[model samples]
Target: MSNNGSYSNDRPPSAGETELATDPASGVLFLSDYKKHEDLQQMLDSNKDSLKLEAMKRIIGMIAKGKNASDLFPPVVKNVVSKNIEVKKLVYVYLVRYAEEQQDLALLSISTFQRALKASEFFIPVLLVDPNQLIRASALRVLSSIRVPMIVPIVMLAIKDSASDMSPYVRKTAAHAIPKLYSLDPEQKDELIVVIEKLLSDKTTLVVGSAVMAFEEVCPERIDLIHKNYRKLCNLLVDVDEWGQVIIISMLTRYARTQFADPNADDDGEDSTNKPFYEDEDDIDGEHDPSKEEKIKKTYSLDPDHRLLLRNTKPLLQSRNASVVMSVAQLYHHLAPRSEVHVVAKALIRLLRSHREVQSVVLNCIASVSTKRKGMFEPFLKSFFVRTSDPTHIKLLKLEILTNLATETSISVILREFQTYISSNDKEFVAAAIQAIGRCASSIKEVTDTCLSGLVSLLSNRDHDVVAESVVVIKKLLQTQPSEHREIIIHMAKLVDFINVPQARASILWLLGEYSDRVPKIAPDVLRKMAKSFINEEDIVKLQILNLAVKLYLTNPKQTNLLCQYVFNLAKYDHNYDIRDRARFLKQFIFSENSKLSKHAKKIFLATKPAPVLESRFKGKKRWVPYHTILTPGRLAIMTCLLSLKFLLILL
Candidate 1:
């Protein structure tokens, strides 16, 4: 055994080295690590699993402390063959940490990990015989987390037995285990399906939510398995824990969407008066489908099962859990007849008053639905108004909803709200406000002049984004009725000197060029000013300046002839290829002697083109606005939320 007196820099100290006796800080730490490594090697080699487990933990502790435990890889990899699952778990964990660097050693553990994966004997005994239900439930929960393919039958057996267990706690844990069991060995899907069916039929509401959740995951397409359980699920929808309610409601929504006729298919496009649904108003309790008496009376248009599902879900609109409310909101959104779809709006508006994040999600749902149908959101227009505490994203979402909800009656109110947004310091948001102003103008023609007047006023706004966005809005308004808006075009032309933003500069140039006669005096001077800064201007402005110069020269070639020749010659040598190419084309077109096209430069450049068809950007944005997705139950998210609930319960 070498003494600790002299340490080798290239090699670790021998297992015989005791205390660190080196001079340098790194040598001392290495020597100290060698001694611990030697102790760990001894502990790992012990026949006692406890000692090996302790060594595995210490290695993990070292790794956690940001120390290099890669030296322990070979020793730890051997323990993957340990009979104790806990010991194997720690060993495999250590191997995963350094598997890339220790490939040969890690490969040695794969067969063992695969073989050990089939071994669940350790948890089975505790899960089966533990007197404490929590211990039994937890044992089964832990057992489910084991990724052993061979343990499926044993786990399935345990799940089947636990599904019928007297304690709801054990049954709930078993219900949760169905997904893990299916994940470990999906071939056992047939057997797991039997188990899920049994769990769904279990009388406990707590177990039912999880059972439905598992059913959705393992056999989501197997709606037939849930058909008999449909009435039961509708009855239990509100009774499940808040987390369970989200899952059950979401499942019911999917089931209803597939199972029933589209509630609005028969309706002509007339305003269906919202049959007002207040909390607990004529609410029927008990496991009742639509009664024979109601069916004979033809009291509802939706199928009996659909109506039953809607009735069962409608009251939960008031659930404190935002997710629960959203789930029900989705229920009404996809399945409710138009008359009843409006019922979910009040609840959605209430949610916008939640904290910033909640408002953001709920606002999206409202936006989507508002686009689908308008009046539902009109009443809550003020609720979507920006609050001082609202973050920039929340403010933008609110602005989108406000614009989507614009009616002739609401347009005045919404445009007034946009005025406030324009004045805010948030540049991105201020720009969106300006764009929304254009959308509002586009959506409602009655408010065209009103929105244009608002935009023209914002051209003088100190914020560059506000001024820039305002220029775009004015152009769109002018495009709406180009001839009627000659005055607005002239007004934009007058402000060209104050607007310096690239897009704003380009926008002014485009309008003046498009309607040059409207501002004949201003157009020539604007082109010369733009020409002075042509090299420094953005690509977009430069392109517009080129087009404007061509248009103006074509209008009166003799007057702009020198300006054209000079500008084209300057652009010809510019660094940008597109600009240079465009310059060459224009210069040739204007001066070509035998190039027949040059003779008709005025006919070519001054030809009147139709106004561009403005696609409602609001229409594109409306697709993302629906909050339905945020509340819709996702497969993995359900498990995560349930796991969190379990963890919280254990903490309590």
Candidate 2:
């Protein structure tokens, strides 16, 4: 390769690779790269150290230029025995570059790296306080990893002194070394805890995280040591690196939960769940300003340090690091007031734009938090809509989040997004969309007509899974409002003969049998169709067939007696034990005048069930506007936010 990135070939040209030269036969203008490679190879085999070092430097330069030089590995490995330390370092640097792709070559060089370490006790202490931070850190790590039992005393002494080293880099290294020493000599764990506590109070954010880690491993029971450092750790949380912030924030969250009273607990005759986080209710939505009496509510109170922690911690939600954002969000959930937990919602939503792995974890947090404090996420509903390119897991979580965010005002827009999802090529996504629609209908009464219409349209879908899952969600909705969706029951019963999915078949039978009073003529017809194929049907469908048969027998004993009897007889001799037992119980209940429980079988199958409240934590409670979040910049505290986000409706 020439310097200007244009190739000059003195030898045969590579395939599709052109050479730039004024003369090709005489080779007047071009430099020969082939001869340059051979010259460098000859220098690597020389007896003098300087020639080998110079040759290795050229190889390092070639590797840095993105050139393949695996042919030089054997020469580099031979140079590790050089008396010059710089030559060994350059050779190792070259070897490390190709370690992953050249695993066999790296294995051949393992003993070479091991031979470079000086692990003797006589020379160990001298390197522990070396002026170079990398050497000081590496020396301790290598010494700790040495397996000789006699070297334990040297490793312990080296760790104790280095734990208080002037360089924070060395102290952080010592923190990692403490755990290894403790593992080798468990007797020194308590003494190591004392050393770790000093490292924790080092007045540097650099060492505090690792010190706490060492403390966690050395003596986790010694949390009493953390009390003095609690305020200091909170102060240094932002200054710490991303990983350090994750560790410290997790430790602080655990500490705050146990020491402080619940942030949601009623304080001085006030229920925080019903109150919003802001001082004025009119600030969040500009549409209707509340009256003065309702606008000014008492602030949800907190302990001083808790207030300081939250005050200092809110800006980290915009961190470039995903784990840092996640850690801060969790801290708010665990320690902040109930009304303020929604502060993490927008931050978590922003993570959807990240890579799929981070998006997955962020979605899980959204799913858990939205189940309890859904109103907190209401403003950002469109952020949860499924993207066309999302993976299956992300799509599933977004579906759950969108379903949980459904409300009377927002259900219309949510149903519109669900309509698009129902048409996707992925069957699982289609089914989840169908389920999301059913959930919206079950939760919001106004949208039940819309969700039912969408689901009924899906019953005509060409994909079998879409129609099957649609039936399952529709069954749940119909069971909840058995009388309101009478028309849906007739439509579902029409597809029963053509449907082959067991869950869908069982769901169809359940809707027909449970609401048999609404579709009386279709009930016996479904039962007659089911009785002919009862032997081939799944156990689930078979059980539902018995329930449908018995429910129909109670409604009209004269017209459906023989049809019900045949289903019962086929079920009685079925392969499954549960099916047989259920069949015998239903047949005895309906056909016998001998049992006392048979008289009121009508009341058993046709009992009226109350509508299910969507399982959520703050469903009935008032929506909360999280702390430090205000639309109008209502106070000086809003200025503390690092970045203010204006969430817009994401247009499809």
Candidate 3:
């Protein structure tokens, strides 16, 4: 072996190598040439630079070969961590490649790595919190992969320091790392609570927001802690100047509802159905009795069943803040798992009866919640059920609520409800109803076809954004319901011609990709409309339109040679590197024999290679307007056309 990375040992074969050690899975020899190991160990111990480098390469290769050669990393870490600067740099480069190439082996040497991590104080932070953002980010990633319980406090300290770090990227990376620590040790939930307290007080909005989100991830399992600290957590909810009250309240609610689950019920334990929390002492059946004298044994294995979090926290449902009220209702749904259907149903009704804002918030929460708790659907559907007799606000709120509940569980009911609303001739309500149905179509095929019947009328409606949102909805619906709904789609294609907004134009073209073979019957015309959008659109819109064109070509390669032409043109002339990259991806996607786009693969390589000075000048400019603006030019053109109008369009 030499410094250039090659095997160097000259020793004879060991007995382990003479006999084949077959693996059960791959049916390959478990051990290879033992002389390779002998030479590697000798070179690793050698002072000669060439042999040492050869040892480094051999160690990496041995680890790659799935041998238990990671026994050498402790010695390797001891050697590398003590080396001088140039040697240390070489060691780091090697370790990083090893970390990247054979992460599991590195992980196997956890105690060895931890010893280096704890002793060489600089390396931990260098990887996790270096002033160089990339180094800090990459180090946190490696540390997270290690998953040792002892590192929790160390990781927490780093998180606290990162909260105040100047770079948003570093802070965001730190925020992500906080959850990874919990993944390694769920018992660190209390430490996470402390981190959340500091994060909520931090000066940076991103830090505070990230901390609140991290709390939502780690704090759920500690519902008893949240129950104990309800007043304190809720007090923070009252701090008037706080901008993240919604997230804080949402976390508290999620914890109350989801995390404090009874493991007995979860695992179908026999004792789960026995009402352990509220058991009447005298009513215990003799047959079901365990040792009556047994004391309550404590272990972290089961979370304390804090049913009181749900039972005691109901008053917050009447709190003035809509977010608080909504969260309280959501919490009841989780904590009251025994009869949660009634609990959520009643709380939602109470919220609806009091305030419009509460109603809207509760409605959003109920959409997804009701889907999971579909048995509660009938009662909730009736409570917010859209009717001519109801107030317009109630009717509008009901439509939104029904739209929200249209996922896997409740889509069938939502479809049936849509027919009832569409059968009536109230055009205004009918339009709103169709939009709600659009929301449902994405989740279920039955509802998508039911809504597809109204596409012709929706396409002709005066409201363009409703039509546009409907187009987006139909695209999603077509994905699941394509074979059965092909005729309805042919009608949708005729309506596609009426949509002039470039955003809608691009969306319609993208949707056609789902039915790539049926582009002729669907919206082949949309490809041309989307392509034209690139001519005068802002660079951002042009980029999106270019993506849409590429997607269309990819979907139905039979009709769209235009994708290749679009890419070739951009690669040759687009001023933006991103635009050139889009062109490159299009070229590779169309021409590469493998044809699969590795999503995580770097896109920059395919990006237009920089033209030096021109690339640097345009580097940070806002390259493109949003696709919605391209779709509806008039709305963007208007100065005070009421952003409220846009809001209404969005809910539709």
TM-scores for all candidates?
0.73, 0.71, 0.39
Cα lDDT of model 1 by residue, 528-567, tens digit: 8878888888888888989999888878777788988778
Where model 2 places Cα greater than 4 Å from the true spot, the runs are 1-126, 147-151, 269-298, 338-343, 572-652
Q: Rank the candidates by TM-score, best first.
A: 1, 2, 3
lDDT of 2 by residue, 1-652 (tens): 2332222323555679654332223333123353366656666777756556656766766665577888777777776556566665676577657654676665555444343234443334444555767666755665565544555666677788788788898899899889878887898876788788889898888898898888777887677788777777877878887888888888888877886667777667644343432233332222333353243234654555566567667889989999999999989987887777878888887888899999998888788778777798899887887888889989998888888878788888888888888778888888777877877887787878777787888899888899899888888877776777788889999998778899999999988877888887888888888899999999888888888888888888898999988888888788899998888777767998776557667776777756655444334333577765645655644544433222111110
- The most accurate candidate by TM-score is 1
Better of 1 and 3 by lDDT: 1
lDDT of each residue in 1-652, candidate 3, tens digit only: 2432233233444657542212223312223553355555666676655555545554554555655564565446544533334334444544555553455555543443343253335224444434466555545555554555655666666676665667766676676777887887787777667766655555454455566667677765545444434434444344422335556656766654454454335554434333433333332223323442132222212222343344334555555656565666655555554454355566566666656656666665665565455566565565767756555555665776666545666676766777677555555676567666766654454545556766545666676765765675566556654677676566666665577555665555554544545545344465565455455555555665565455555555567675547645755476778777767756665556564443312342223232111111112222566666564667654734577466446534
- Residue 326 of model 2 has an lDDT of 95
Q: Weakest 10 consecutive residues, lDDT, candidate 2?
A: 643-652
RMSD of each: 13.4, 14.5, 26.4
Local distance difference test, candidate 1 = 0.74
Off by over 4 Å in 3: 1-264, 268-332, 340-344, 357-368, 386-400, 404-435, 442-444, 487-497, 520-534, 537-581, 584-652
Model 2: how far residue 440 lies from native, Å: 1.2
